[model samples]
Target: MPPYPYLATDYDGAAAHAAIFMVQWKREGDSLARYLVRIGEMTESLKIIQQALEGVPGGPYEYFEMRRFEGLKDPEWNGFEYRFISKKPSPTFELSKEELYMRVEAPKGELVIFL
Candidate 1:
């Protein structure tokens, strides 16, 4: 059996290799084997988080685009304005009459929406 089944195609290759070794050595229904795979996945996730944190650029982290709306006031500050707050009403949109379908991989399972 292939470790990391067909549906797990989006996962990292190194993790899949590690899973292959675990699957080859362990019994099919072993709880400890499952726990170890979970641990390995967590470790891989932490490594990814660390790399992302290191790559992040130094900040004035907050950015807000200055937008012009009929009822809103003009922004007071030029660069990195801290006091500006704008609340605009949501714009109306027109959708086509045709059917719309969307699918997303949720945590528990696949989620689908149809309109």
Candidate 2:
């Protein structure tokens, strides 16, 4: 996978979010196999979320499909407030896998539990 470019936001301003951590982890592993494995795990978690949302009591499940290619390719920086918090590159940026996993999974698991 190529380095994905995006302005990552922190939810709690505690650490750089998952994507940033993935990019760095991809670099740290520095191998195709490791990179694929890491991404596979992340993708699987996201898939679990998608599966859990299937055929729910809503018009449609929309979280995973919220962003389109055009939006990311040319994102509009209109100063609109984002749902997620922004984490600037800083000395205190935490890049631990445990934190990243918790950030991504805990919320989803909570939602799934509620469902």
Using lDDT, give the best candidate's number: 1
Alpha-carbon lDDT of model 1: 0.47
Off by over 4 Å in 2: 1-30, 59-115
Name every residue pair that clashes in candidate 1.
none
- Which pairs of residues have clashing backbones in candidate 2? 10-85
Candidate 2 — worst ten consecutive residues by lDDT sum? 81-90
Tens-digit lDDT string for candidate 1 (54-73): 65566564333334233445
TM accuracy, model 1: 0.33
lDDT for 84 in candidate 1 is 33
Please provide, for model 2 over 58-114, each residue's C-alpha lDDT reduced to its tens digit, 9 standing for 90 to 100.
556555424432254323321222234322222223566544412223543422111
| Candidate 1 weakest ten by summed lDDT | 14-23
